[model samples]
Target chain A: MHGQPRPYWNPLVAGLILGLALLATFLVTGHGLGASGLSARLTAALGSWILPEATAANAYLGGYVKAGAPLAGWITWEVLGVVLGGLIGSLTSRRFRPKVEGGPRLTPARRLTYAFVGGALVGFGARLARGCTSGLGLSGSATLAVAGFVFLIAFFAAGFLTMRLARGAWT
Target chain B: MSFPFYDSGFWPALALGVLFGLALEGAGFASARKLTAQFTLRDFSVFKVMFTAVIVAATGLWLAEELGLMAPRSVFIPTLYAWAIAVGGALIGAGFAIGGYCPGTSAVGLASGRWDALVFIVGMIAGAAVFAWGFDAISPLYWAAPGPKGQTLDQLLGLPVPAILVAMIAVAAGGFWLGSRLERRFGGPIGSSDVTCGSEGAQPPETGTRPGSMRPS
Candidate 1:
């Protein structure tokens, strides 16, 4: 049972905290945030377990396979912390309700389908770029990496253009 | 000037990860609606937070190096892979438009107990598997268009760090100004479903409680 939920923090305020968090990560870990790498590692590990011969021969998955344990990297541990933090934030703020979130117009099945399809595209793209929004989009751009800016523009442009598709069924 | 403390181990990683998560959840990113609102022009929180965070981080990073408090190149710098990221980021964007959740946000959404977020994660894993399967074909493009390692925008443009950063700030300010106008025009904050729920994990569903100012009827 969820109680009254608090409003979200103002964007700038939250952004400050986020920036500090990222800065703290750099000062402490010599790197920035990441998310998609975990998926890659997981997939590679699963492949290694399920089809060792074939997976190990894979050009990308093999690199991960040879890279030792999937969870050995620092990003994995950080991402675990992120998951825990999310739960803690939700519980404390009374925002922790277990439900499939979709707008009124969307059916649960359709939302879930959208989620899966979208997630797949994001996963593939993030891996191709060697990072996702948090990884390359935020961290890289902050460091002024040229690819980061390039990624930023490309990502947002594509998103705005295709957003109508997402809401098409809703209308 | 590497910081020896960073070598201490996973404790920092774990602790920092928690902080990152708290910031994201606290920012109201745990909900898919909040994320997608920016795309719809109903809410600009994503753009606001993104620009501010990146600017602050870039400034902080530069200051730390300037003050010699942080090690030179202590943080990981993203490499330049022009085509790979160009193509890949577009895909990610398209996915975001459709899914309304990125990899990190999906994690937060999952923590909030959304089944869709879980499905998203599963899809992500499957998608990664697809990339792994086709790595041979993709590897050529992925490896192509390599730029110098650790190339900064300042270096690329032959400008000082401060100049580039300041210019970015100006650009962001302009974008922010424009974004506010867009929000005003759209008339929205398109509240998510069950933004205000009763005592139940699964609240009764409906069209969002607060529709945007000009949502297509």
Candidate 2:
């Protein structure tokens, strides 16, 4: 397996591990997993950094500021852990490499642009919905939250419906 | 009050997050191509992993509650902000199709050294800032009602938690079966065969492959 990344784990096996991890999260924190919330907080912190008065004056950013140090939140630390974990997994699997991922038809620049635009959309939408795939779909659904199911359905539906427009980028 | 773990501080959260990230990367979710394949209907790994995880967690949570290990009320559940969630979900879906990475997976991708993932993260932060700046204007849409507070499937359907969990497991099983069939029909080798891990400055890989030929077991 030298110079070759190991094949991905069986989906069921990986999912089982993930499920147990989520169970652990619930049992310990009385809360589910999340990703976007930390991003939102980081963004608010950035806002406050550049423009303190306005950031504190804005309703949304201000709320985060009032909550104390944005990076001090548990979710922020969790996200940091995620990055570390990913690094460990990639290193062990020998998949760590700096590269742009895109279809042959997509130039590296175009792919990067699309990634940024897509990320922005995700950021905005997650805040609007108050969560993302992890928060609303995985965590919420696991706990039988109605919003989780609704989000799961709506998310896939929208993805399927609009995928054609972006087909070239991936396909 | 049934569980005293929340008071244990941030270490537990961090450790769980690490596990979550490891699971995601181990499942090949660090690859943008693999993730986007779900939208293309060419691969079902995304659906498979997600549904399985959901079912497993849901079952475990339900079992814990039944055994009196934890109170259902102690778990944080999102309140239903119906229209906002629907609209937001749609936007997220579109982003997923376009970007091929979500907040969680993007972090993994970035860790695995994907340059695009870093750009995506920056974009995400900018988008969040835009939302913050426009919160007052968008509050109505974001906070739209017809929203019930903390509604769960069991409560909504007037069914027992176990019954709901059973239904969810059934759905997951059905989904997995269908996903396998789809993979057989549409799956192919990911991108170009020349593309390998840890190859920086490599050219973009060619798209698609002969259906049913390169499906990973």
What's the lDDT for all of these models? 0.82, 0.83
Per-prediction DockQ? 0.69, 0.74
Each candidate structure's count of clashing pairs = 1, 0
Candidate 1's docking class is: medium
- B135 Cα displacement, candidate 2 (Å): 0.7
In model 2, residue pairs whose N, Cα or C atoms come closer than 3 Å (at least 3 residues apart or on different chains), thus clashing, are none
lDDT of each residue in B1-217, candidate 2, tens digit only: 3762674367877798899899988888777878888887777778888888888888988878778888766788888898889999999999988887889999999998889888889988988888888888999998787557789998999999888878877887898888877766765324322234335442544434454544223
Per-residue alpha-carbon lDDT of model 1 for A29-128, expressed as tens digits?
Answer: 7778889989988898888899999988887888777877865787788889999999999888888877776655677788889889999999999999
Q: Which stretches of candidate 2 lie over 4 Å from their true place?
A: B189-198, B201-204, B207-217
- Each candidate structure's TM-score, on Cα atoms with residue i matched to residue i, is 0.93, 0.94
Candidate maximizing lDDT? 2
Candidate with top TM-score is 2
